[model samples]
Target: MHGGTVRPRRGWGGVPKINVYLPDDLAEGVRAAGLPVSAICQRALEASVRRVAAIRRTALSAHEDPTAGLNQFTDRARTAIRTAAGRSRAAGGQLGTADLLHGVLDEGANLGVRVLRALGLDPAALAAALPQRPQDPVGAASFTATASAALELAVTEALALGHDFVGCEHLVLGLLAEPDGSAGALLRDRGADLRPARQAVVAALVGLTRAAPDPLHPVLARLDRLERHTGLAP
Candidate 1:
């Protein structure tokens, strides 16, 4: 690991080369001029990393995540958030996309779990795929930048679905929205894409849609569901 980032052996001394493409003419000219392209690229990437790190720090430095303003999370969603935070703490790392996935699976009774099962994605396997150690360490914070972004996306998903409260299924959708994030990548690699997962959610909740008084009908119904709540799914 070079500077906390895993690198493949490519350049001298186990350094990885980030390929920089250039037009033939430009490449020829640069080669003729013997320009230090590697150094230039390193400098540019470092500057970009600094800027991104600053933005992330700004987002997470607040004691409470801005998503708290849209606090219409159902019981399972709230529990999942708390569970994710707890796992992050126990792992000695900041809350991240993987932790959020873990939270959903940990709860074991949410629509999130059902969606995974319906997709033929094993929740246990997904949880096992989570890195035992933090992938990249960002300093102390309630949630990583990716995690915070996913939470915002979760609210968006809930709103788009015409639901009054956020559900664990929405959290799954949020994580999927951030495909560059760790857990998102894991899910995508396993063929659990967004549309099909939502299809699964809709299928499970179709029975509860009629004559419901509030938007929380699906979420509450899922939580209070006792049939196959432990090992079985929705």
Candidate 2:
């Protein structure tokens, strides 16, 4: 990382070596911090593999409806997804993250709405900020790559949350987590950063509110950390 050689790490048998390039400053920083680049890369790669596996199970083909096979997501989330599909169809395009955001806002009763409000996001305003599309129609619509990726992240989020049921909140997190999506940017612009939004989600689901911090928060956090450490986390 400095004047010394950066060598390929030795691992389990038959594993190939590959170099991970880093900026001079960042490499120096990592050296100074004593961070293990190989371990970091391995963990990240493993997580990515898990995420890809999850997506493949739910992925729709070219001719498949974007809104179809969404029974894995909650009923309310499915309804909102219909709104997204309709919006995409009316716009004469593939479903996108923007449309997904609308799906979160289509139903006022969605837990996603309350979760956003809890994070100080105005759901109504967020929906209004997106391009308006006709809401009446429900049809099979393909999804943009961005939308597909976001939905994939939604599944990942549900797994991370240890949730058997994928909810609207997970979709909200997915929209906010998908780096290439404008919907994620919109949420971040409204201060819905991934970490806090995730915390807000946990709190909301467990009956916590903005009024005060839940006493169970620390316990939950510890348990979550333990879950990851035990390799039980997704």
Top-lDDT candidate index: 2
Q: Lowest-scoring 10 consecutive residues by lDDT in candidate 1? A: 224-233
Model 1: how far residue 104 lies from native, Å: 0.4
Q: What clash count goes with each model?
A: 0, 0
Q: lDDT tens digits, residues 23-85, model 1?
A: 565567667889898786676556444433432443333244423333467788778876676
Q: Which stretches of candidate 1 lie over 4 Å from their true place?
A: 1-70, 133-140, 208-234
Residue 178 alpha-carbon offset, candidate 1, angstroms: 0.8
Taking all chains together, the TM-score of candidate 1 against the true structure is 0.58
lDDT of 2 by residue, 51-160 (tens): 55544454333345544556567888887777677777766667889988988898678778888998998887998888777754544456778888888888778766
lDDT of model 1 at position 111:
83
Q: Rate the local accuracy (lDDT) of all candidates.
A: 0.69, 0.73
